[model samples]
Target: MHDPIWQAEKKKILTRLSIAIYKMTDEQLISLLHLFKDLNLKDNDKLLEMPHSHADGVVAARDRQLLIARFFLLINQLSEADLLKFMNRYEQKRFSMLREYPRVPCNITLDLAADGRAINCSAMDISAGGMFVESCESFTMNQPVSICFSLAEDQLALKIKGRVIRLEQGGIGIQYESLTKYQIEIMKNMIDRLQRQASSQYRIG
Candidate 1:
């Protein structure tokens, strides 16, 4: 089902983006063009302001990262709301390690087993390497555990072993020890579905 509210929000976001790009100074425009090359933005030939081009060349089909960089380069022209939005996004991206797989924020109920005991807990977020599980129970770093859960609308079952790598206030971070090929595929699919859901919610919100 197509969401009308999300469509409207997307339209508003594009409108704001167009207005913001239009107000960029020539110097800022040049800076963005260089940043585009630095980011290796895809289909970059489409970015050139050809002799007959009428638009600013920051069109819809451009890479999301490229668009984000342009926003940061032209932060002075954006409204307070838009500036804060892009700044926060950029700040978060900066903290992420370039070599690490980005974590997908989600809440998946699963059983966390440790030392022959299993407790139901919520998997707060997941990445290619591991997941952060929220529970009232305490866990020590390097504790071995197994996570069992269903995926693909509960059509398939999954169980994998991991080790607690970090202990936090309310939860523990578990890193996958030895993942099979099948486990990797299902995890990728789960992350893909989660990211799509998050994108829709972010647009509407």
Candidate 2:
């Protein structure tokens, strides 16, 4: 067990990364999920990668789900070039991208675009054009979805319409549609903020 304060304290820094972050199609997320689950990862501070032997049932089982969110949030913030380098290690399988705007790590909820069915989901990353959301709910490719999430520095929640461009076992890729002028501005500003933060950290580090 860890302190909750750690999550809140590290939220800002953890969310921004100096890399190319792209949305993943559901097909790709499923594969990535499987790939990561079996990884013999060293115990890193930002992520929880418990060894399978020490992983008892129940608690570890629950954390694995959380791990999916945590791990992918980290993954989504990696530069596309970096991600490709990492994925290329899996020579047998190639990870594909549906490409548009780069993604910034974000946590948000998803709603049905047509009927506003609310689903609790975390965003792996986001962009003015679209985002990648992780959820186990049953949804088909091309389904319409509405995203409701807040920028790290802003309290105001953002709602935008998107289409499910792709699907994977653990998440879905959404492509923005009919974005308003205001929404576009919000995304641009947020992206700028993340970029600025990442650059600042680079200089400091």
Candidate 3:
């Protein structure tokens, strides 16, 4: 087991990432949970290619049930892109954002233009490709909607026109309009830097 201080720091970091982080879909969140569990099971700090043998049975026994429930809960709360971004960040812990840029979570206020209906929401996760936003308002699945938000540092304000791909309690899933080449470049750079830093630190420590 890691030392008390180390464990505390790890939990603290995870908690901070949870709150400040963007959204994640149910499928993505389950994958992340599995990743965390797998990382923890590594004895020498090297990530395992598969789950440990000892726990393999347990993992397989209830995999379907666990996935269905977990996925439902995540859909109720997180967004797809946010989910992907956080999973990437968690997988690349303790890296410099400059060398490894963390996915920037967007906090957006969505407005329904038809009647000026609006709600305050934020991403559960984000990537240059797309993002997931948690909403209090529910919409029919595959319904088209208008979205607006800024990228990191509020530098780039984007008004995207997209559709709701999935729907659940408290929110609906959206796939944003396609991103520009520049945005994709920025996201990839950030992810690469963070991943390298995480791997290096894990090796040294």
Residue 104's C-alpha lDDT in candidate 1? 92
Question: What ranking of all candidate models by TM-score puts the best one first?
Answer: 1, 2, 3
lDDT string, candidate 2, 1-205, tens digits: 1457644534433343211112333233344545544443444444534423222222233444564576666554544444445455433444233232457776555444445567877777778767888888877777777777766545777787678887888988878765555666678787777768778888999
Task: Tell me the lDDT of model 1 at 31.
Answer: 41
What is the TM-score (0 to 1) of candidate 3?
A: 0.36
Ranking by lDDT: 1, 2, 3
**Candidate number of the best TM-score:** 1
Judge candidate 1 against the unseen true structure and give its global Cα lDDT, from 0 to 1: 0.65
What count of clashes does model 2 give? Answer: 6
lDDT of each: 0.65, 0.58, 0.49
Q: Per-residue CA lDDT of candidate 1, range 110-138, in tens?
A: 98889988799999999766899998897
Error of 3 at 39 (Å): 42
Candidate No. with top lDDT: 1
Residue 68 CA displacement from its true place in model 3, Å: 36
TM-score for all models, in order of appearance: 0.51, 0.45, 0.36
For every candidate in turn, the CA RMSD to the true structure comes to 17.0, 18.5, 15.6
Worst 10-residue lDDT window, candidate 2: 17-26
